[model samples]
Target chain A: MTKQRAGLYTALTLLAVLFLIPMIWGVSSAFKARSDIFEYPPRLFPAEPTLENFRAILDGQPFWSWLLVSTLVALVSTAVAVFLCCLAGFGFAKYQFRFKNALFDVLISSLAVPFAVIIVPLFILLAVTGTLNVWFALIVPWVAPAFGIFMMRQYVEQSVPDELLHAARIDGAGEFRIFLSVVLPLLRPAVGALAVWNFLNSYNSFLWPLIVVSDPDQYTLPLGLQALFGAEGRQYDLVLAGSVLAAIPSLIVFFVLRKQLLDGLTAGAVK
Target chain B: MSTVSAQPSWWRRNEVRLAPYLFIGPFYVLYALFMIIPIGAGVYLSFTDWAGLGAPQWIGLENYRYLLQDNSFWTSLGNTVFYMSFTMLVVLPASLLLASALNARGLKLRDTFRIIFFVPVVISPIVVALVFGLIFDGQFGLMNALLQAVFGFGGIEWTTDPLWARVVVVVLVLWRWTGYLTIFFLAGLQNVPRELYEAAALDGAGAVRSFLSVTLPALRPVTAFIGVTVLVSTAQIFEEPFLLTQGGPGESTLSIAMFIYRAAFQRQELGYAAAAGVLMFAAVFTIGRIALRLFQVGRNA
Candidate 1:
């Protein structure tokens, strides 16, 4: 038994190291001078590390602007998406109105519709309507994601009791008031999970933003990094620095909410 | 007082029946506008030729016919299928193994391992691609350097060779997604009744037998959910190949999504791109529906 346990830990430790190498290497490379990035017998830690890459990218490019736009888009979209999803999920979970199953089926089936299918027409639709503003285009269309609704529905069903809703209704509480005061508080963990998920999605989104946001001045982090990488020669130093910085917020958010995110994500699937 | 007491007002009386509709209304409204209408427009655009300018010229079946003969379209479709199969076969099973290991009773620092494994997914795909591109570069890459030191064989052509390029993409997919899927499986494993395993042990069933009979059956729902999710998402893979190889060394790793992006944005073949998109939608939607039925997902709900 001891031998088996030892084997397990060894294997787990090895796998963990394998998982961490790329990020560690990338972070290390970000600090390395441009000349030492591809040094022979590639060292895991930078020898003569400097702040030049980070300083150069920050000073020369609109790094913070890209970060701001990405953060704002992710934050706003997450907030709106969480509210709409929770409301819809509550409706689906607690109610048995007409066409409920059919409505749910429609919503769930929409998940299968590839984004590639909508890329062309959605772009044109936004263009034709003259509502192609970055904020509107990014946030409004995606604020009611089906996955969020599904996750919220599963959580509501599991955690919130039908009797509680009846009690609230009996106490002369309006439906919206009940949801706001009662249901919303109950959905805190799932909300954290969904918010992080939505934020990462919006923040990391590349293709949609790449197609829609043409103006360089309005580029998101991914677009700005892509531009830097694809410029005259690959701006590896700037991009690596930008990549490291771009990853910090997401990593911090994930670490802070790691428990809720993991548990909340699996709540729907486990049953 | 009379007005306040009059049948408790019409709004109060009907709120129960109408509240659900109101609650779910916003989602359906946005869904129809963004999802249904755009799909309708995509279908319409598929039948016409447009270049982001004036009214589209109706060219019935021409794009589809052209796509039928387009080698790049076929190659992209083939590569996408390869990617999808790899995820199902390689990544899914690997995750299950990882989850099983993580689920072991009294395992130390399980949470730490889980978090570390999941870090790749939290990072942006572009960052992932750049890091991977540097590590796997054919010349002077960390991977090659390590290979040379370990096995004395280093010239693997990670990016330049067609087969190696596809392998690199799959490796990236595995690294990025295995942990994400593992958490779901771990959750499923945790939920499995401990009594079932005890009963299996009492029946003289060994670890493998108990796992087959108890754990596998218990994990069906999660596996189904993950299966369908992975299928649909992998069907539309883009970033890895696009960023790493640019579908190069002769379009060997070009995904259908990349093909569409190139055709529509780079080549200005919007109609052709839409046609390709329609085909992908049909395939994915059909497969997803079939998988949903096969798994009986959401049936209990």
Candidate 2:
């Protein structure tokens, strides 16, 4: 490589390190006790690294309960979203139907509308129906993600052949059976991708849960973490611990399913 | 084949095509309940006098009229614009440059670097705000410590001072979003044809020239998508400002969404809040379309 090329590479290396600093900070901060956090010279390596924050967070709040609630909600919601998206995607991809394009357009356009725009009426509707505290409040809103359907449709169109569906039907398989037996089994990759995306979104969600679920007992992880910052008092150690705890599930899921996560994001963007 | 079955007319076929509708049934029903009806309700309520738990009075265009004269509403709008521009002008380019550099073939440990850069994108924004809040702490912060180490000057009150608080919020938005944008640009860059780069080189185009002529044009769609999404999302900036400054040290970082949330949830002025939301929705959609169009024109040129 030329001198300039080498120099450019070195510069890029520095940039990457700069990008890595926050994650380093988060992990390092999580390890430090209260005194070590605000040290004057700022300790890159905490002199007395501790897991007190983790312990406190687990003990102080109903951290375990909140974690369980968030996990269940994210998993259940993603499963529903993936299943519904598969059925819809296969139908859209395979069959020619009346008003298909019109219905699809409505769903596509709905993707661009911000969640904030719908919060008001949805909140009112939830309140009126008295479903505010139930798991359904979070699950129902996510069941029919427009982007998920769009993604699955794109995947199915590209991957699932029409002949397969025809052959299955020729064997006397019903439409529902064809979907369950033929289309869905082939859609596992898209399902996996959409599932991770949905889980991350549902888990990281803040605004909707904040508005809809008033009771602390019904709080998702993000909402529960937010409460730690509220009037009861700001315990920095406890908050950091809670934030770390809240982030772990998504991190594990992200790492395990990195490729699908990328696929889901870009495909979701393009479609 | 002995016989061929005839295809039925479209609607006749579709009547049994309850299959497609059935497939898509959940989304349609949920969209109506969760999205469409709510949007219509929000629009109708914007012209009324409704609090959280009461009948909405049909109070003409008073809410809109009030919004016109409200100084805080205007201030929040200005802040939104400021934050949007700050992120676009500074963060977008920085991330793009960083992405391009990382995508360079000469770069070693590429995947590790990408993962590091993408960490913030996955982490909770609320947690990011908390970390930033600590970093920008007035009395005892890492930022102040660094400042004292180098310049020996007093630390600026990051979250307390109006101007500084806005700056901090902008920084928080940038930090949270730049990594996310980098991943998008990286994805876009991976698809750019390498032959164009080789052609540019053979034509004696310098690295900069190749980047300008060959690389940038290929990134146009990705840029357009990210630019519009960032603009729209920034216009609704909430979590960072909400956690960092609590929309303070006097509404410096208060965004339109934050304003709407406060009005509806805290003040219980649901109708006026809906007006604020509708206005926000309009502004974001308008700005996004305009940006995408401008980017397309520039790309064509």
Candidate 3:
């Protein structure tokens, strides 16, 4: 039994090390001066450890602007999605209106539709509406996440009792008032989970934003990073630095909301 | 009962009851406009020869017929399938193995490991591709540089060489996805009843034997979900290959999604591209159904 326990510990440690490789590489590579990045045997530590890559990415590119775009879009979209999905999730979970099951089925099945398949039509829609250059194009499509609604529905159904809702209603609470005061408070944990999911999904969004926004100033961090891939001139260190920049927000969110995030992901599988 | 008046009529009496729909109305309307209408449009556009701006010329069944002979489309389809299969073969086992290890008792800094593993999934694809592109760079890449130093061998041309390019793509997919799948499997592992393991051990089942007989079988549903999702998502792989290889090294790494995008946007053949997408979607759906059924049967057996 002691031997078995030792074996498991050894295995887990090795797995953990393997997982840390890329991230370690990302940060270490960022500190390497441009010239040292492609050095033979790839020294794990840079001798000079210059922040040239970071400096170049920051000063040369509109890195701050792009980061701002990403933050605004991720935050605003997450907020909108959480608000809308909570109401929808609560309605589906608590109330039995006409065609409730059918509507939800449609919503869930819509999950299979990949964004790549819809990019062109969305582009066309935005183009016709003359909202092409506007930030609305970047924000709107992500604001109504079906998965968020689905997860929120599941969480609310299992956790929030209908008796509580009825009591609140019996006390002459308006429907919206009941939702805001009663339902939203109980949904805090699920809301935290959904917030992280929506933020990451919105922040990491690629295809739609790639096609919709043509202007550099309008570019999100992901799109801006893709723009760096242009030209034959390869500044690998700078690219890695930029990638590290792109990854930090989502990584931070995952850490801070780790429990909720795990629950959100596992919710589907465990169900 | 005395206080209860006539039940509120569906429309007038319960107009306030419609608040949920009112809250949720925006999403459905947007989905209908951006998602539903486009899908319908995509299906229609597939039959017609629509370029981006100009009026679409009706070419019923012709685009599909052309796709039947389009060698590049077939090649792209084949490549995507190959990539997906390779990812499943390599990454699936790795994920399960890692999850098992992580589930082991008294692991140090396990949460830290989970976060690190999940970093790839959270990072933008463009960043992943960019870093990978540097690593796979033919001459200046760290991969080749290391190969030269350690093994006294010349670096393989990763992006420019056809076979190597495909290998790099598979490797990228593995790197990006392995952690995501591991987390799912870990979750699945957590829900597994601990008593089953104790019972298996008491029956004199070795670790390997017990895992094979018990844990693997128990994880069948999550396995099925992961398998179908991974395959479908792999089939639609775009940004990684788009950024890394740009479907180059002689079109060896061109995914069906990339093919569709190229045909539609780059070549301005929206009709043909839509047809290709529809075909790809059908292929994915059919495979997903088969995989799901097989998983169910395997579980039952």
Candidate 4:
């Protein structure tokens, strides 16, 4: 490589390393012994790595239960959200209905409503519906987020051809049948991307679940991990361990779907 | 033809007539119930004195009046504005440059760098704050240790000093979002035709000159979207600062969201909290709309 090209690559590599250090440090500290965690000239790797913190969290705390709750919530929310988005998106993309634009406008505008503005009244509504501490409450509000619907509409417009739908209709295929068999199959990549995105969003959600689920058994991993930090012992080691563990599932989801996710967002929105 | 006359028009048929509405109804129904109704009730609650129970006593504009004199509320809003602007300024430019670098010709391992940077976006903000909290610790933080080891400088109190605390929060916010903005710009960068750059190059424009004349103009819409999104979400950024400093040693980092949460839950001032939320919502919405309009005008110019 020429000198200029070599210098550019080196600069880029250094910046990338800067980005990677926090994650590396977080993971390294998670394994260090409680005393070693705060040592001077903070080491990148533990002097003598140990799993005692992880063991303590798993043995005594309800870590597994929280993980289960978080996983269930993430999976259920993603499945329902993607399905609902596809239906709404396809409807908007293909169908000429009364007040379609007006209704869609309202939905789009509501996306701007600040979360704090809604949280109080939503809390009241949830209490009235006896939805607090229930999975139904945990999963319902996020199931058809307006952004997801908008994303799906963009995807449908880009990939799903109008002529195909017309031909399906002429073939005596019902709308639902055409959608399920023809349009949906074509949208598989987009759906996969949205599913992964929604899963991570749901998994990282803290404020809504923090308010809705009062039961210790219902705590999501983020909330549960925060509780570990709040406990009187103030176990930074345990909290760090829990944080890294919580991130593992998301990283796995991210690695598997990164390309699809980026391509999905790019296909319609920007590019 | 006889069958067609006997059959109702496609739009009038039962299944065909209802399919579109059915497909779209679930989303609107849930949205109205969960989002619209709650927002309406919040607006109403802002006008009354309700503490999560009993009949709400109507007291028009009283909460707003009290809020006018409330120093804490003002301070939190001030802190948020500062934090938001800091990250927006730093992160946006950094994202633009990084996206450009990643898009440069003959750049190897671009995808790996993209993934590395994007990790921060996926990681929980709370976790990011916690990690950085340790990094900024006065005594044994990685940052402090590095400074002393390399420059022989004394460690500064990152969490206690109000200025340093705000800086820490800004750094954390940038770490959590710079990659996100990078992805947005990356997508925007891809949409720009290479021919534009080539045309400008042929006109005796250097790389920087062409980038300015060609690249930045194409990214206006993307920047507008990012701006409004940041505005809306900045109002709700509770987790990061709440974890990092719990609003700090002197309430230096307290955001309006934290204030509202504490008001409703801790102080049972639901009406007051709702009022604050409604006010902030209106302000942010107007500002966001104006920002988008300005971006459009800039593009047209």
B-chain TM-score, every candidate?
A: 0.97, 0.89, 0.88, 0.91
TM-scores for all predictions: 0.98, 0.90, 0.90, 0.95
For candidate 4 chain B, the 10 contiguous residues with the lowest summed lDDT are B292-301
In model 3, what is the error at residue B217, expressed in angstroms? 4.6
Query: With candidate 3 superimposed using the best TM-score fit, by how many Å does residue B246's alpha carbon deviate from the native?
Result: 1.1
Q: Tell me how each candidate scores on DockQ against the true complex.
A: 0.83, 0.46, 0.47, 0.57
Ranking by DockQ: 1, 4, 3, 2
lDDT scores of the candidates, listed in order: 0.92, 0.79, 0.79, 0.83
Comparing candidate 1 with candidate 2, which one achieves the higher TM-score? 1
lDDT tens readout by residue for model 1, B239-290: 8899888998899999999999999999888888989999999999999988
Model 4, residue A42: C-alpha shift (Å): 1.9
- Ten consecutive residues with minimal summed lDDT in candidate 2 chain A? A262-271
lDDT of 2 by residue, B40-79 (tens): 8889988899886668899989999999899889988999
lDDT accuracy of residue B217 in candidate 2: 83
- The true-versus-predicted C-alpha distance at residue A187 of model 3, in Å, is 1.9
* Model 4 clashing residue pairs (backbone): none
Per-residue error (Å), model 1, residue A77: 0.4
Query: Candidate 4 - CAPRI tier?
Result: medium
Candidate number of the best DockQ? 1
